[model samples]
Target: MSNCSFCQVIDETLRPGGIAIWLMKEAKEDIKYQVPFLLAVYLDENVYNGALNFNPWRWMEPENEEKRNRRTSPFYAPFGGGARFCPGAELARFYIALFFYYFETTYR
Candidate 1:
């Protein structure tokens, strides 16, 4: 789920301090920055417990379901966000569900 994000700084900005300053100490205006995704989905300790362990039952847990319904988990952006959100996200989900339903019934 790692992705590179590229954008130009619209205005000059200064960091308060303590963070590792990259390239310019201060973000200069109109500078196009190429930043790689620092967080890998599977490696993210904030989300999953262990990558090797498959725990589908975790989704059924009350607290986990609550977080999903609220959309508070930052690690779960599959269709992207904001104005660039995928227009067909809902359609894609519907198609997946339809396929699973047909496959289950036919196989059974």
Candidate 2:
């Protein structure tokens, strides 16, 4: 149940032979679909906090473009990635954050 797309590599439940699509660095310009791109790198310093902190501002700060890039950087894809990415991903994140906010504040 990890939120990282990189963690998907260590996930054992995905179907075998399943292929993920992505835009490669040097993909053929003529055929966009043919581009070979798929990845994850959540452990990077700028990507995640190494499970050390839960500062939502790392992602929610309006002036921090670098931190915001993490949203679409494939380092964290609670919804999904590539063309198959969920359109409601942001809404889903909002609900999840809401749930956590209430659960933490109320249950505490």
Instruction: List per-prediction Cα lDDT, in the order shown.
Output: 0.38, 0.41
RMSD of each: 14.3, 10.2
lDDT of 2 by residue, 2-92 (tens): 3353323222112111133344355455553544333333334454554243343344334333423323544444334666567775565
Residues 41-88, candidate 1: write the lDDT tens digits. Answer: 423555545523444444444644432321234444344444544577
> Stretches of candidate 2 above 4 Å error?
1-40, 45-57, 60-64
Worst 10 residues of 1 by lDDT: 6-15
TM-score of candidate 2 to 2 decimals? 0.38
TM-score of each: 0.51, 0.38
Which residue runs does candidate 1 get wrong by more than 4 Å? 1-39, 66-72
